[model samples]
Target: MKDLFDYCDFGDLKLNSRIVRTGLWESQREKSGNMTPDIYNRYENIAASGVGLIITELYSLYPRDTFSKYSNTIHYTQFVREARDLTDLVHVYDVPIFAQLGFVQYNKKTQQNMKIEDVTIDDIRKIQTDMIIAAQKFDFGGFDGIQLGLGNYYFLSRFINPNFNTRDDKYGGNTFNRLRIVLEMIKVIKDNTKLHINCRLNAFDGTTNGMTLTETIEIAKLLEKYGADFLQITLPRSPQFFTRENKEENPLIEATEQIIDNVNIPVILGGGANSQNQINEMLNSTNIDFISMQRPFVKDPSFLVDWQIKGNGESFCKTCNNCYWKKTATCHLRSCNP
Candidate 1:
C-alpha cells in the first residue's frame, strides 16, 4: 500500500512525502516584483510543514503578459537574489523547490497578444531564448527544477494546440511539428542547465479540435523523450474547473493513470484532492506517486504538519477559490472555517 507520507525517490530527488505543493497567484509581492516578508514567511511555513516538494507560484516569463500583474516575473532585477534566499530556506527543511515559469499572452512592444499562427520564427526563437535565460536564473538561484507551464491557457499550450496553432510551417501541423518549438527549447535547457525540467500539461482540453488525452499522451512521450524529468497532468482551467463540491467522477484519475502507464518519468495527478484518506486511496489504487495541491496550502501553509500528526486529516480549505480569483496568496475564508 502506498502511503501519502512515505519517503520516496521522485527522479533523483528524495522527498519527505508524496505531497507536492504547487503555487499560483503571488498577489502579495511588491509592485516592483521583489519578494516581501510575507512571501518569505509563507514559504518558510510551507517548508517547515511536510510537503515533499514545492513549486513556486507562476514566474511570468515576461512583464507585460496577462498574468504578470498577479505573478512574479523573471524580468525583476532582484529575481535571482531573492529566489536564492527562498530556495535556501526551503532547503533547510531538506525540501527541493521548483520554479514555475510561464505566461498566458505573448506581447511584444506594441503587438499586444499575438496569435499562435501569427508568431514568426524570430518570435519563436526569442521566446525560447528568454526561457533558457530564465532557467539559468533558476539554476543560479539554487532551485532543484523548473516547472514549464505548458498547461492551461499559456502561450505554449496554444502554440502546440491544433485548434489555436494552424500554422503549416515546421513549427506546426503534426504532433511532432507542433511540439517542436517546445522540444527544441527543452533540449537546449537540458544541455545548458542541471535543473530538472518538469512539464505541466493538460490531460484533455474540451475544445472540439484542441488537445485530447491521446494527443496529451503523445505529448507526454515526446516531452519525456526530449528531456522532461517528470510530468504533472492537469486540465485546461484546472483547479477552478475542479472543486471539491463537484463530486462528479474525476476523469483526471483515470487519465493520469493512463499517462503514467505511457511514460517512464514520474507523473503527478494535480488538484481536486483534499483529504489524507482520499489521497492515500488514489496513491494505492493507481500508478500515481506524486500529488499536487495549491489552494489547501494557501488556506494554511502548515496544514500538512497537522495531517502528518493526525495520520488522517481533511484540509480546512473551503474551496471557495477566493484566493484564485481575488489573486491573493492568503485564503479568504479560513477565519470562518473554524
Candidate 2:
C-alpha cells in the first residue's frame, strides 16, 4: 500500500509524496503579490507538515494584474525573490514545488488605469514569453516545474471559454481551435526551460454551453501532445447550478477516469477529494496516478499532518461559494464553518 508520505518520481520532477497540494490563493502575500513574512511562514509550516509537493497559487504573468480586483501591482523581481525563498525553504524538506503563471482580467481598476489589452495574438505571445521567463527563474530558484491554469478565468482559460473569449479567429472556434492558444503557450515554455510542466483542465464548466467530458478529453489529448507532463482534472459548478439548486453527481472523478483512459501521461484527480476512503478509492482504481488537494489543505494545512498523527481532519473548507457572492473574503486560511 502506498502511503501519503511515500515519494514518487512524477515526470521530470521528484515529488516526496503522492498527496500533492493544489493551488489555493494565499492572500497571505502582500496586496502587490510581494512575498510577505506571513506567506513565507505559511509555506514553511505546510512544507514541514509532511506534504510531498506544494503548488503555489496562480502568480500573474503580468505583474500589473497580481490582485484579483486588479487594483494593485506586484514587483516582478521582488516577487521572484520571495518565491525563491519559499522554494529553498521547502527544498530542505526534500519537497518539490511548482509556480503557476496566469494573467487576470481587469474588470475596471488597474494601475494608472492601463487599458485592458484585448486577446490579440501579440498579447498571447507576450504572456507566453512571460511564463517562460518565470519558469527559468523558478528552476534557478529551486522549483521542480511550472504549471498553467489553462481552462479557467485566467488568461488561457479566458481565451478558451466562449463566455470569456469572444474573438472569432483561429484562436477561437470549435474546441480544438480554442486550444491552439493554450498548446502554443506550452510549447514556448518547454522550448525555453528543461523543467516539467503541469496544465490543469477543468472537468466541466457545469454549464450547458461550456465544457463537457467530451470536450475535456479532447483537450487532454492536445495537452499531452503539447508537453504537459501531467493533467490535473477538476469540476467547478457555475453559479447557475446554485441558483437552480440542482444536485446531481459532480462528474469530476468520473471525468478524470475518462481522461486517464485517453491520455498516456500521468493523470491526477482533484476537487472535493479529502476523505481517507475517497483517496484510497482513487488510488486503488488504477485509473488515476495521483491526486491533488486544494480546498482540503487551504482549509487546514495541518489536516494531512494531523490525519497521520491523530486520525483527525477538521479543515476550514466551507465549500459554501459565498466568498464570491458575499463579496467578502471568506476562506482567509481558517474556517470550520461547514
Candidate 3:
C-alpha cells in the first residue's frame, strides 16, 4: 500500500518520504544577495526534518526580474562556493536538494520588460544561453537537480500561453512551437549538465483563450518526451487560487490526476495540502505518489518531524498568504518550533 512516509523512488533519486518541499521567496538573505546564517540554519532544519525532496527558494535568473529582490541570485561571486557548502550540508542529512531557477520578466539593457511577441530570435537565444549557464553553475554547486519555473505566471508561462504569445514566428504558433523555446533550452541543459530537469507547470490558467487543461496535458507529454525528469502541477496563481473552502474535492487535485495520466515521469501535486492524514488520504486515493508543500514549511521548517512522531498531525499555518504577499521566508505570525 502507498504511504506518505514510505521511502520512495522519485525518478532516479530516492526520497525519504512523499512530501516534497517547494519553496518560493527568500527574504532572509543579505542585501547583496549573499546567504546569511539564518538562511543556512533554516535549510539545515528543513533538511534534517525528513522531507523527501527539498526544492530551494527561487534563484532568480535575472537580478532585475520581478521577484529577484525576494529571491536568491547566482550573480553573486560566492554563489558557487556557498551553494556547494549548502548542498554539502543537506547531503549530510541524506536529503537531495534541487535549486529552483526562474525569472518573471525578460528585460534587456535597452528594452524594459519585453513582451513575449516582441522578443526577437536573438533575444530567445540569449534567454536560452543564460539558462544553460545557470544550469552549469548549479552543476558546479553539486545540486542534484534544477526546477525550472514554468508555472505561476512566470515569464516562460506567459511566453507559452496563447493569449500572451501572439507572435507569428516559428517560436510562437502551434503547441510545439509555443513550447519550442523551453524545449530547446531543456535540450541544451540536458546535453551539458547532469542536473535533473523538473518543470513546474500549470494545469489550467483560468484565463479566457489562455492555457486550458487539455493544452497543459499536451505540454506535459512533450516535456517528458523531450527531457524533463519530473513535473510539478500548479495553477497560474496557486496560492490565491487554493482556498480552504473545499478540501475534499479540489479541482487542482483532479486536474493533477489528469496530468499524471498523460505523463510517464513523476508529477507532483503542488500546494494546498497542510495535514498528514489528508496527504496520506490523497496518496491512497489517487495515483499521485508525490505532493509538494510551500507555506507550511515556511511556517515551520521542522514541522514534518512532529508529523512523523505524532502519526496524525496538522500544520499551524493559517493560510493567510502573508508569506506570499510579504515575500519573506519565515512566517509572519508567531514563533514556530517543531
Candidate 4:
C-alpha cells in the first residue's frame, strides 16, 4: 500500500516524501527584489519541517508584470544572487526547491497597464525571451526545478483562457493556438537549461465560457508532450467553486485524476487539503502522485512535523485567507501567532 511518507519520483527530481509545500506569496523581498533575512528563515523552517519539495512563492519575470500589491519583481540580474542565497539555504536540508514563475500585465497601481489581448506577436516573443532569461537565472541559482505558473488568472492563464484571449492570430484561436506560447516557452527552457519544468495549470475557472475542465485535461496532455515534467492542478479563486461543503472529495481531485490518465508525468493536487486523512484518501483514491498545501504552512511552519508525530490531525489553519490582505504574509490567528 502506498503512503504519504513514501518516496516519490517526480521526473528526474526525487522527493523525500509525498508532501509538497506549494508556493505561497510572501511579500518578504527587499525593494530591489532582493531576498530578506525573514524570507531566508521562513524557507529554512519549512525545509526543516519535513516537507518533500518546496515551491517558492510566485515571482514576476518582467518589471511591468506585478502579480501582487506588495511583492517585488525579479527584473534585474542582481536579484538572482539573492535568489541563489535562498536556494542554497534550502538545499542545506537536502530538500529540492522550485521557483514559481508568473506574470500579470495589469495591476491597479501600475501607470501603464496592458491586457493579454493587447500583446502583439513581437510582444509574445519578448515575453517568451523574458521567461527563458528568468529560467536561466533559476538554474544558475541552484533551484531543482522551475514551475511555470499557468494558473491563478496570471499572464499565462489569461492567454490560455478563451474568454480572455480574443486574438485571431496563430497565438489565439483553438486550443492548440492558445497553448502555443506555453509550448514555445517549454521548448526554450528545455533547450537552454538542465532545470526540470513543472507547470501549475488551471483545471477550471468556475465561470461561464471560461477554460473548462475538459479543455484543461487536454492542455495537460499537451504540456506533457511539450516537455513539462510535472503538473500541479489548481483552480481559480471563485466563491462558488470547490466549496467546503464537499471537503471529503472536491472536484479538483476528480479533475486531477482525469489529467493523470492522459499524461505519464507526475501530478500534484492542491486545494482544500488540510489534514493527513484528506491527503491519504486523495492519494489512495486518485492517480495523483503528490499533494500540496500553502495556507497550512503559513499557519504553522512545522505542520509536517505535527503530521509526522500524530498519525492524522486537522491543521490549525482556519483558511481565513487573511494572509493575502496583510502587508506581509502573516497569520493573524492568535494560535498561529502566539
Candidate 5:
C-alpha cells in the first residue's frame, strides 16, 4: 500500500509526501499587488502544517488582465520582491512552492473582458512575452516551479474551450489550434528559465461542447511532449452537476486515470477530495502520482497534519463553499463547528 506520507519525485521537485496543497484564491494582497502580512502568515502556517508542496494563488501576468482586480500581478518589481520573501519563508519549512500563473485580457481603458476572437497574432505574442517575463522573475525569486493555470475558467482555458472560442483563425477550430498559445507559452518558459513547469488543465467543464475528457487526455500527452514537468487535472466550477451526491467514483478521478494511462509524466488529481480514506482509496485504485486539495486546506491549514496524527481519518472541511464568496479563502463556519 502506498502511504500518503511516502515521498515522491515530481521531475526536479522532490516532495516529502504525496499530499499537495493546491492553489486557492486568497484576497489578501495589497493594492499594489504585493504580499501583505496576512498573506505571508497564511503561507507560513500552510508551510508549517506539513503539506508536501504549496501552489500559490493565481498571479496575473499582464497589467490589464482581469485577474489584476483580485490576485497579485507579477509585472511589478515590488511584487517580485514580495514573492521572493514568500519563497524564502516557505523554504524555511522545506516546502517547495510554485506560483500559479494565469492570464485574462481586459481593455486598457474600459477594463472589460476582451473577445477571444478579436485577439490577433500580435496580441498573442505579446501575452506570451509577458508570461515569459513574469516566469523569469519567478525563477529569479527562487520559486521551485511555475504551474501554468490553464484551468478554472481562466482566460487561457477560455481560449481552449470550444464553447468560448468561435474564431476562424489559427488559434481556433481544432484542439491543436486552440492549444497553440499554451504550448508556445510552455516552450517559452522552458527556454527562459530553469524553473519546473507544471500545467493545471481542465478535463471537463460539465457543459455542452466544452473541453471533454478525450480532448484533455490528448492535450495532456501533448503537454508532456512539449516539456511540461507534470500535469494537474482540474475541473471547472459547475456546482449543479459535480456537487450533487454520487456513489460512483468522481469524474475527475476517472478522467485522471485516462490521462495517466496515456502520459509518461506524473498526474495530480483532486476535486471535492475531503477525506483521507477517499484520497488513499483513489491513490491505491488508480495510478495517479499525487492527490491535491484546495478547499480542505482553506477550512483547515493543518488538515494534513491532523490526518497524519489521526491515521487516515476524514478532513474537517464541510465544503460549504463560503470561502468562494468571501474571497478570503477562509472557513467562515469554523466558529460554529468548534
Candidate 6:
C-alpha cells in the first residue's frame, strides 16, 4: 500500500505527496486583509517542510465577503499581484498552492454582518453571472486552481441548508435543487478557464436537522458531473444539522468513507485528522485519495515533512481548537486550544 508521501496528480498540478497543508484559518494576514510577510514566511516554511499541496485558509472572492478584520482576502488587484508573489514563493520549494475561495452569507459567526434577501429568477441569474466574472478574474490572475467553499455554503450552502434556506423557489428547495447554483457556478467557470476547480461538500452540517449523509453524497455526485477536479469533503459545524457532540465522536475518517463510496472523483477530507497513523490508513484504504487536516497544520505546519520521514503514528498536535477560536476572537494568532 502507498503511504501518505505518494504523489497524486489533479489536472496539470502534480503533488509530490498526498499530504495537503489543510485550510486552517492561520490569521497570518494583515488587518487590512493583505498578506503580511509573516504569512508569506509561514507558507515558505510549510513548503520547505515538504507539504504536497498548501491550500490556503479561505480567501474571499469579493472584498465584501471578508469578515475577518485581519484575514488575507483576494478580491482586489493589489491582492492578486501579491498572491502571485506567494505562489511563486511556494513553487520555489516545489510545492503547489490552491487558494480556497470563500463567501458566507450563512456565516454563523457574523450573520449580522451579511445581508440576505432571497433572489428572483432574474436576480439569481445575475448573481450567477457575477460569480462567473469573479472566477474569471481570479483565474486570469495566475492562481493554479480555485477551491469552491460550496460545502460550507457561502451562498449555495445556505440554499441547501435547511436552517437558513427557507425559499420555495427552485434554487432553495430539495437537496438537488440547492446544488444547482453551485453546479452552474462551477460549470460557467469551468467553461471559461482551464484552471482546476475543486468543490467542497458538507459531510455533516453540524446541525440538528441540517444536512444528512444522503444529501451530502448527492452533492458530491453533482460536483463529479460538473467535472470538478476534486471533491473537498468537510463537516460543517452548523447549528441545526451537524453538532459539536457528533463532530467529536465521529471524526473525519468514517464520514470520508461514505463520501468516497459515492464519488468516482478524488475525495479530499480535512478536519481533525491529526495523526500520521490515520493518514496512512486513509491512503491504504484505496477509498480516500487525500488526508487533509487543518488544526494540525496550525499546531506545526512543517509536521508533514517530519511525519513523512519518520513514518510515526502518534498525533503531533495537542488537539487544540485555537485555530477556530482565534478567528472568532478576531485574533491573528491561533487560540492554542491545547
What's the distance in Å from true for residue 150, model 1?
A: 0.8
lDDT of 5 by residue, 286-334 (tens): 7886988787777777767777787867777666667665666567886
lDDT of each: 0.91, 0.65, 0.91, 0.80, 0.79, 0.67
Kindly report which residue stretches of model 5 are placed more than 4 angstroms away from their true locations once superposed. Answer: 108-111, 238-248
Candidates' TM-scores?
0.98, 0.81, 0.97, 0.92, 0.92, 0.83
Q: List the residue pairs that clash in candidate 3.
A: none
Model 6, global lDDT: 0.67
RMSD of every candidate to native, in Å, equals: 1.0, 4.3, 1.3, 2.6, 2.2, 4.3
Worst 10 residues of 5 by lDDT: 238-247
Candidate 1 structure quality by residue, lDDT tens digits, 310-338: 87899998888889899878888846653
- Residue-wise C-alpha lDDT for candidate 6, range 44-156, written one tens digit per residue: 88888767777877765445554534345655558667877888888898887777766664223334434334455665676677667766766766666777777665666
Which residue ranges in model 2 land beyond 4 Å of their true spot? 1-3, 63-74, 106-118, 162-168, 237-249, 312-338
Report the lDDT tens digits of candidate 4 across residue range 291-333. 8888778778777877888888678877666765563555778
RMSD of 6: 4.3
Looking at candidate 2, what is the lDDT of residue 9? 74
| TM-score between candidate 3 and the true structure | 0.97
Show the lowest summed lDDT stretch of 10 residues, model 4: 238-247
Which residue runs of candidate 4 sit more than 4 Å off their true CA positions? Answer: 66-69, 106-111, 238-248, 336-338
When summed lDDT is taken over every stretch of 10 residues in candidate 6, the lowest stretch is 328-337
Residue 229, model 3: lDDT of 99
